[model samples]
Target: MRKSELDTPCILVDRVKLLDNIRRYQGYADAAGIALRPHAKTHKTPEIARLQVEAGAVGVTVAKLGEAEAMADGGIRDIVVAYPIVGSAKLARLIALARRAKITVACDGIDAAASLSEAALQSGLVIDVWVEVDPGYGRAGVLPGADLDRLASALVPLQGIRVCGALVFAGHSYGAETDAEREAIARNEAGTALLAAEALRGFGFPIESVSAGSTPVGRFASAMAGVTEIRPGTYVFGDVMMVKAAALAIEQCALTVLVTVVSRPAADRAVIDAGTKVFTMDGEDSAIGTGRGYVVGHPAIEVAWFNEEHGILKLPDGERGLRVGDRLEIVPAHCCAVVNMLDELHVLDGDRVGATWRIAARGKVK
Candidate 1:
């Protein structure tokens, strides 16, 4: 069926644009001599993960153990749980997941690594782990100086876990106001991880992989020497936030939410069927332009506010032709969060619905 004929507040992904995005980034990684490991947290669908793997991604990266499980069930053999997996309950699950695939987990401290080592020893399986280093994100990771030295020393005695290398996330690049600033952040991110890896190797640790990158800084981060792999998620489906960060052009946004104008309360006010539940509240703290979402082809229009089930739009002046039952496409502020709010994505074949892919890893927060 045609997109216009579909139900309101549904997702639409352009097939041609999607494939182009996959190939374009894969080509960049191949030329840079760095492995591309597309983070599955963006699409969270096994089918899209397979497409990335087929296009040249060495494996897929996930944010949680549940997402890793979904990918493994979908026949993906190599997976990376980029986040720390703590707690005994989760260790058991992580060990079980290792039996199904070559699982690589991350840790920033000796405690988590020791826990993983104990679990792997009990399961009689060696787990590959990348030490996550803080790249000024102020999130979860050890600093690149004496602290990192201490952690590396502490983890060296863990027999059940193998220290692969260091990893960094250039997430702070999202706050960059200019292209130069973003590139600088990317450089620092990769450099920090590489430095950590070098220190680990000097400490008699077998440092094999140095993974770093995010969608905003993936290109610059991958170009840096010593970065073995780059994990970018949002590059597969561009969004308004990415456009604002100068990482992607607005036209590269393949995924959009198709919503219908449910009511024209006033000449300047138009209400949509979708709300925060659909588009999410990701761009609230941004100093950049645009509101909750970017209205496709309607530059003057802004998503003024949203309730659970209602989206308020401020229309442009002059001939305001938007009426009830009018369908509008919105490029969400954040594609990853928006994808998690849906059950499936409607792939478009031109103007018709081509296929529907299940969001296999949505809500897999564990």
Candidate 2:
């Protein structure tokens, strides 16, 4: 298979670039004296996860139990369910997963902790737990201080749960418009998580792991004082968001959508085969020059709109270099979401096409 032979609206991952990203992140973590447990939700493929582990990743982090089970089935032993899993049916599967591999979970409240403990106790497993700290994401996680201590204290009475330490996701760091702003958020993520870890320790709980993760923060991981683990997903496939934030380079982008120019309706506009279905509505970035996605080689073109199957492209300079049947490579704003929209990614080792990697964890958002 070759790039020219691949159909439009397809995904292509440069193997060399992918391997480079894996090793680069691992090297950074090694130099900082921290473990790199990459988030598998980015690629959602066991093949990629294995490569990450082989490249010195301590383990893999997943956003759901379904993804964890898929990775575990794919032969990954050390897996962390980064999301809080609740309910009996889900807990049963969660515990069953514990029987096969070492599992750690992140929970923000005592209720989540108690439910996890019940699941662990049912399976007769002592699973490690991380107290999620709200590092300004306002998503999940309890704030540090009384809430942190309270969760740890609640876990003390639980038979199957052990408080490992603290974890944080500096998602707000992604919105940073400048290097200084990004670095500032990175420091905040590390500092806030460290405070929670220290508070957990002050309560006489054993604080073994302090984890902070985000591609933006991962760039300045050295700011993470007292952090023992770092998990970054998008570093594997630098998207438009990472590129605009100065966290990644355009050349470092490993994943892109192969689209074909299907219509040249006007001189200032054209249409491509790829649209929201392929590149998705990953949306805008402050630093990125375009919305939805940016054409890899055609800076003169902007992806202005999408109509499911059609991509509305515009030329700011009014120069129509694109013609009907022309193909374009798009670096999407969010590679993770773009990946879930597809079943397989056509891979490349330099110019030669490699075997396709199945999205083993797709739709496993349990």
* Model 1 pairs whose backbones collide: none
Each prediction's TM-score versus the true structure: 0.97, 0.95
Q: Which stretches of candidate 1 lie over 4 Å from their true place?
A: 284-289
lDDT of 1: 0.87
Looking at candidate 1, the ten consecutive residues that score lowest on lDDT are 282-291
Cα lDDT for residue 196, model 1?
91
Model 2 per-residue lDDT tens digits across residues 1-366: 778888878889998889988888888788888999999999999999999999899899999999999899899999988898888988888888888899999889888888888778877788898888899989898977777777777767877888877899988887878888888887888899889988888767788989996787786877777889898999999888888877778889999898889999888898999777877777464245666677877766777888889989887765587789888888888899988898998889766688888899988888
lDDT of 1 at 21: 87
Candidate 2 residue pairs in backbone clash: none
- CA shift at 247, candidate 1, in angstroms? 1.5
Best by TM-score: 1
How well does candidate 2 score on lDDT at residue 245?
Answer: 72
